[model samples]
Target chain A: MKIAEIVKTLDGSVILGKENLEKDVEMGFASDLMSDVLTLQTSNILLITGLSNVQTIRTAEMADITCIVMVRNKKVTSEIIDLANENNIVIIECCYSMFKTCGLLFQAGLKPVY
Target chain B: MHFQYSIEGGDFSRAGNASSQLKKLLKQLNVDSQLIKRIVVALYEGEVNIVAHAHRGTIDVDIEPDKVFIRLSDEGPGIPDIKQAMKEGYSTASQKVREMGFGAGMGLPNMLKNADKLNIESEPGKGTIVELTTLLR
Candidate 1:
């Protein structure tokens, strides 16, 4: 599904990479652990995480994850947004919890990374 | 070609800078995408290790036609038990580092999984050195 669609479905707001909302996301992985994200080998995965830190962006960049959805309306710092912009990673913020966000995305036809 | 980057221990902000630069370099060199992914993962993990554990470290990257070789040497409290350190869930990172979503003890195992050749050497009071090699396919 496209990021735009996911945002609309989850009532999310784009905090960065606004131009990338139309980008296609093939899979979704939700985790707060950067280590687990690094272990993933998939490309174009949408990282649904509650961790709002620079390391989230760094992990996304290393894993080639193009999109991130910050759940529970986590406070994303300016530095994190700036890094996301620089890396061309789309950031979406939503009030839904991680579980709810994943469910909404899954219901919308996004497959799991497994 | 060769490149070098220095890492400051406990500096979480700049942890992945070297790996990001190396990824761009490999892309510019037209290396295979799969090989590039492996190299980036391995090197990024090594870089994070230095940041989380060592006092300071250097990342030396040597790119050849067939393989990308990386040497990460750090000055800090070295790993006394390489065997224990190699375990998947073993980490010595402080509580602060753990809060940043790292120090889960998966760094070395992740490196081993991604690199074609991996070697680690360390002395308890001194430091640690990790060598990683990924062949371009």
Candidate 2:
């Protein structure tokens, strides 16, 4: 699925890297733990997390995650956005909780890789 | 290319600066993305451990043509049980560290996973040294 589609589905705002919205994503991983995301490697993955911190961006960069979806109405700080922009990562803020965001995306065909 | 960074404890905001700079350096060197990712993950976790657990420490990164070596040395309350600390979901970090989205007890295991080789030596109540290496190929 294209990130543009995911944004439309979630009615999310692109806080950064909006031009890369058309990038393709194969799967989604929802976790706040950075190590979990690192251990479970997947290509072209979108990471959904509630924890908004520098480590979140660092984890995304380490795993080469295409985009990050901040659920539970978490605000992406300037530092986070700056880091994301530097790493060429796309950020999306969604009002839906983590579960609902993942559910909607999964129902929309972006299944998790177990 | 080689790099060295001093990590100060209790500074959550500056925790991953070393990893960030190394990531940029690796990219500029045109290192393989996979290899770079492994090196970054391992280095970042190690750096965070120093800042969270130790009073202070230093990270030495040796970037070679075929491998990257990262050594972290810290002066703090050393691990009494290396085997237990190596286990996932086991941590000695305080509650304040846990609230920062870290201290999930996954730091050591995650570092091991990312590095091709890991060597840990610690003296309880003295200090600890962790060395990690990742092969480019």
Candidate 3:
């Protein structure tokens, strides 16, 4: 599914990467653990994480995850948005819990990264 | 090309600086995308290892036509048992590190899995060194 559809499905707001709204996301990986995120080899992957920190952005950068869905209404700081923009990653903010966000995306045909 | 970067222990915000730089360099050198991805992931994990566990550290990168070598050495309370530390899901990181979504003990395992070759040496009460090699061609 494209990032735009995922946003619509999850009622998420785009915080950055307006250009990436049409980019297609092939898989989803949800984790609060940065280590787990780094272990996977993927392309066009979406990272669903509630870990609100600069390291979350760093982890996504290292892992080449294209889009991030911040769950549980996690605050997206300016530093985080700046870093994401620098890395060319798209950040989406959602109020749903992690499970609900994943379920919604899965119902919309997003595959798992694993 | 040879490059060196200094890592400040406990500085989580700056953990991936070296990895990002090396990634750009590798891309400019036209390293294979798969190889570059693996190398960067392993290097980033090594970088975070120092930031999360060490006092301070240094990273050395030596790139050859066939392979790239990286060494990370840190000064800190070293791991007393290398075998135990290498195990997945074992971590010594403090609560703060865990709260940042790390300290899950998958760092070394990811490095080992991603790098073409991996070597680790540590001295108890002193520090540790990690060496990783990845082929570029």
Candidate 4:
């Protein structure tokens, strides 16, 4: 799925990397734990997480994850946005819970990394 | 090429800086994407381990034609039981660290899984040293 389609499905707003809306995402992984994210072997995955921190962006960058959807209306600071932009990672903000966000994306044909 | 990064313990904000820099360096060096990913994951975990447990540390990286080697040595409360610490679900991270989406006992194991070779040595009250190597092929 493309990042733009994920935004439409989840009613999310692009907080950064708008130019990357057409980027292809092969899978999705939802986790608040950066450790678990590191364990994933897949690339080009969309990270659906509620944890808003610099490590979240850092983890995505190291894992080659290009997009992130922050669920539960989590507050995203400018610092986080700056880091995401520096790494060319798309950040999306959505008001749905993590479970709902994952469900919506999965329903739209995005498979899990498991 | 050789690179060194200093890590201040308890500085969660700057945890993965070294890993990020190393990733960029490896990319510029034209290392294979898969090898770069593994190196990044292992190195990032090592960085986090220091930030979560040690007082401070330094990461020494050596990038060569055939492989990349990383050594992370920290001055902090070292792991007493290497065997237990190497367990897939064993971690000694503080509650605060765990709340920040880490400390799920997967860091070291993840590093081991990604690195072609991993060596860990520690002294109970002194510190710990983790050495990781990955082949570029």
Candidate 5:
């Protein structure tokens, strides 16, 4: 699915990389652990994580995840946004819990990386 | 080409900078995307390991026509038993590190899975050294 549709489905606001709204992401991986993310070995993944920090952005960059959906309405700092922009990673903020975010995206045709 | 980066222990904010830069270098050299992915993942895990466990460390990356080699050497409380440290669910990371979404004890295992070769050397009081090699072919 294109990222824009995902924003609508989850009532998520684009916090960065709006220019990438049309990018296609087919798989989703929900994890707060960066190591689990590195193990994915896939690209164009939508990382559903509640861990909002520089570390999260770093994980996405190394793992080549396309976008990050921050669950639980976590606030993103400027450092995180700057790094995400540098890495060309899109960030979306949502108030839904991680489970709900994943379920909603899964229902919308996003495949699980597993 | 050879590259070097330094990692500061407990500096979670800057942990993956080395990996990111090495990734860009590999891309500029037109390394295969799959190989680059593996190399980057392994290096990033090593970088994070230093940040989470060591006092400080240095990363040396040597890229050849057919391979990439990385060596990380850190000065801190080294692992007394590398076998235990390499176990999938064993970690000595503190709660602060855990709060950053790391410290799951998966770093070394991920590095091993992604890198073609992995070597670890540690001294209980001195430090640890992790070396990873990935063949481009």
Candidate 6:
């Protein structure tokens, strides 16, 4: 799915990389634990997480995950957005809860790449 | 090329800056993505470990045409049992660190898994130094 579609479906706001709304996301991984995400290196995966810290961007950068959807209506700070911008990763804030966000994406045929 | 970053312990916000910078360097050099991923991931985990658990540390990145080496050294309470620390889900990080979405204990194992070569030397009370190397053709 395209990032724009995910944003529209999830009612998410783009925090960074607005220029890449048309980029395709092949898989999705939802986790608050960086360790689990590290264990699953899904290239270009759409990462959905409740964690809204700068480390989340760092984790995504390390894993080469270029898109992040923040669940539970969590607001990402400017620092996090700046990091995402620097890493060239797209950031979106979703109003849906973590479980619902994951379910919606899964229902949309986005499976785990790992 | 060589890059050095002084990682400040207890500074959670800036933990991965070194790894991120190194990734940029690798990208500019047009290094292999697979090797860059391994090098940066291993180095980032090591850098996070230093920032979250150590008193102070430094990350040294040595880049070459065929290999990238990272050496993280810290002066802090060393791992008493490296075997236990290496376990996938064991962590000694505090509640604060856990709140930041870490402390699930995959740091060491991830470092080892991502790097083609790994070496760790630690003294229980002295400090710890982690060495990682990734090869690129």
Candidate with maximal lDDT: 4
What DockQ do the predictions score, one after another? 0.85, 0.60, 0.85, 0.90, 0.89, 0.86
Q: What share of the reference contacts survives in each candidate? A: 0.75, 0.47, 0.82, 0.90, 0.95, 0.82
Runs with alpha carbons beyond 4 Å of true place in candidate 3: none
Better of 1 and 2 by lDDT: 1
Question: Which residue window of length 10 is worst by lDDT in model 6 chain B?
Answer: B61-70
i-RMSD of all predictions: 0.7, 1.5, 0.9, 0.7, 0.9, 0.8
All candidates: TM-score = 0.98, 0.95, 0.98, 0.98, 0.98, 0.96
In candidate 4, position B37 carries an lDDT of 92
Candidate 5 lDDT over residue span B8-84, tens digit each: 99888888899999989989999988888899989988888899889999999999998899999999999998998
For model 2, residues A74-94, the per-residue Cα lDDT tens digits are: 998899898889889999999
- Can you tell me the DockQ of model 4? 0.90
- What is the C-alpha lDDT profile of model 4 across A1-114, one tens digit per residue? 889999999999999988889889989999998899988889989999999999999999999999999999998999999898899999999999999998888999999888
- Ten residues in a row with the worst lDDT in model 1 chain A? A14-23
Name the docking class for model 5.
high
Q: C-alpha displacement of B121 in model 5, angstroms?
A: 0.8
DockQ leader: 4
TM-score of chain B of 3: 0.97
Give the per-residue lDDT of model 1 (tens digit) for A1-114. Answer: 999999999999998888888889989999999999999989889999999998899889889889999999897999998888888999999999999999999999999999
Encode model 6's per-residue lDDT on B4-79: one tens digit a residue: 8898889998888888888888888888787788888888889889988999998888887788888899999999
Q: Candidate 6: deviation at residue A16, Å?
A: 2.4
Candidate 2: tens digits of C-alpha lDDT, residues B6-123: 9998888888889989988999999988778888878888887888999999999998878888999999898999999999999888876776667888999998888899999999
Residue A15, candidate 4: C-alpha displacement in angstroms: 0.3
Per-residue alpha-carbon lDDT of candidate 3 for residues A32-68, written as tens digits (9 for 90 to 100): 9888888888866999999988999988888888899
Report the lDDT of model 6 for residue A4: 93
Per-residue error for B60 in candidate 4, Å, reads 0.6
